[model samples]
Target: MKKLITATLFATMMAGTAMADTTLKLVEVITSPERTETLKSIVGKFEAENPGTKVEIISLPWGEAFQKFATMVSAGEIPDVMEMPDTWLSLYANNGMLESLEPYLKDWEHTAGMTDRALELGRDVKDTAYMLPYGFYLRAMFYNKKIFAEAGVDGPPKTMDEFVAASEKISKLPGKYGYCLRGGPGGLNGWMMFAATMAGNNEFFNADGTSKFSEPDWVKGIEWVVDLYKKGYAPKDSVNWGFNEIVAGFYTGTCAMLDQDPDALIAISERMDAADYAVVPMPKGPAGKSFPTIGYAGWSMMSASANKDLSWKLIATLEGPEGNIEWNKRIGALPALKAAEKDPFYAGEQFKGWFDELADKDAVPTVMPTYLEEFAFFKDSLAIKTTQEALLGDITPEELAKQWAEYLTAAQQKFLASK
Candidate 1:
């Protein structure tokens, strides 16, 4: 009778275990059909491997993602796991909204295979990792061979001065512009790249935590942009052009060159002929230095998540070798997994430019001051406003430089004080 009772209790416990439900809400930041579908497929595999743990994907459009996510968080509708761009990762992690993955990473089998940079990408000021990077986005210059040949420019510009000359030459073509300037939203990249290149050093702060935008070299970089705009090197209408407009400008023969990340290739490849264009390392500054920035997107677990272990399992599967390669293949981003560096999918002529940038010892890879939550404000608002003013001849480069220095110094002081 006792043996029978034990068996019945064991069966009841087993049934209870099977009845427990753990649902993970995963928010996808990129809402493209292909990417969303690929994520669903990966989630399906994860669900199969870990029965009774279901993942529900919440898709957010890239355009409205930030505002919408802010609203969701304010509304207390936090997900179990969410796509975290490096730009937003620090902000979220710093605010204690993210679950630090340090403990989980120490025992994670996949952590051993991740690149040092990939592991470091999600680190906060205190060096605690809150996310695992899925992929990297690095800048390279894409140029039109047909336009170059027509402009009599022998090759891609090697220096900022040469870049100006090439742009001028290209602009001589009727109804064509030299550079596909991203003047609208997401235009901070062009501003930062040029400013850093001109400054010789990409570092934003000095030893005492002072900002560097007002430095003479950085001013020169801002001057270059202003000069280009006043000289009609870029389309006048491009002052309001964002990613779609800029890519269309390049692919439709409206612009001769564009400095962009590998992800831009996915869209460009669909519209432009391969033989007509090629990518190269960004042009150096007068100081013979080029600071091409790199950014990444990763997966982070919300601190509010009730199923941390299961959510981590989903992250591991998605960032693992097979899944990383598959996702990057569709996104045209560089896989953050170190082993993926040798994947055959990235071993193509079309990918040569990014590879060249990565291999170029002279080209320094840079990331912006994403640690500051106000950085998004600077990126999406201040930079755009001042740059558009400079382009319109409403502000001199020096004035623009001073404005940046004053604003960033204040932000830097606040950030340091908080620390």
Candidate 2:
């Protein structure tokens, strides 16, 4: 009996030594309760499958992540793996801080299941892929079915004219507005989509790097939003509504429709019943075109990681078809793996709208200007303030367009010069 006990103790010690041979530190830039739990679950499964591997996750607050990550890099305390946002991709990849995943992906069987677009999303300016995006945050229209019924609208609108008509009818309901306008922080996506659809094209920059906001079609797009606000199709107070307020407005039935990403589904599902709400593609312009903005955050490996193969395995397990679907289920984003879209979970009403848009093949998928260093300031500060001003009638749409054109031109010049 004593020998048996000693043998067991020896085995346990060997197991510990084996695990100590490989430990991976992963950083998550977008910190939240839901994302934390989801990461834990994914890592837990990876650890179980690979007995000698251990992963430790370090989550950083979204607002301070850039500064904090820079400090870590300066200190040489880089993690083995990290959640890479699009805006930060050029910075890290260009600096040689991130590992190129092309070689690994070439040998990875799981890459076969991922979407071509997702695989290309991680490419650096030199065209090397350094990250593998797990999911897409693409825009779709979320409408309150009950409100539509009460307003006597037939169904979700397919054209801009139908959208305005529906909004007018829905606003006629006592104490309810037709649309929720995001006129506050992070409002740029809404503005861009509205302008893109109205213009029937989504080009932002010319070959010479000049901005298209000053163009007639894009100006008309901005005018449409101003008209909607001034004509009372949207609530006056909505001029101050950001993400939370607009989401609340939709779920509480204060607004009939909201154009948002799939991530909004998480909050909507918590407060509203399944039957009360549904999602649909963004309405098309007079020229029959629609553009929905697409953004993604992905997993990347540090170039200095001691165990590149094992680190990539962890990433594969997280972004594989099974893992991608499971992760997106909790985070409320669309899976980067195309096969995951066929899963039963995506067949529900809440997800059908986005699926329909993807199927349409004509609705353009738009990407923001993440290559510019000043993009954060432009998105979080200048765009919000100027758009709010335009909504308030403080500036004409043409004036707003001219302001945007000047700013973008200067920013583009700076970006090019730095390159």
lDDT of 2: 0.86
Query: Which regions of candidate 1 are displaced past 4 Å?
Result: 1-22, 417-419
lDDT of 2 by residue, 1-419 (tens): 99999999999999889777788999998776888998999999999999878898999876567678888989999999999887678678877888989998889888888888887787744678888888888999998989999999998999988989999999888988889999885678888998989988888888777899999999999999989889898989888887778989998889999999898888899999998889889999977889999888899999989989999999989988778888999988888887886788888777888878888877888898876656656775778779889999898999999989888888787777776
Assess the local accuracy of residue 336 in candidate 1 as a C-alpha lDDT between 0 and 100. 83
Query: 1-419, model 1: which lDDT tens digit per residue?
Result: 99999999999888768645678899998567778998998889998998777888999887567778988999999999999887787678878999989999989888888988888777744688888888888989999999999999999998988999999999999988899998887788788889999888899887666778788878888888878878999999888887778888998999999988887788889988999999999999877889998988889999999888888899988988888888888887888888887877788898998888888887899999888877766776788889888888898888888898888888788888877
Off by over 4 Å in 2: 1-23, 50-54, 60-78, 230-232, 235-242, 304-310, 371-377, 392-396, 411-419
Candidate 1 lDDT for residue 119: 80
Candidate 2's TM-score: 0.83
Reference-based lDDT, each prediction: 0.86, 0.86
Question: Scored by Cα lDDT, where does model 1 land?
Answer: 0.86
RMSD of 2: 4.2
TM-score of each: 0.91, 0.83
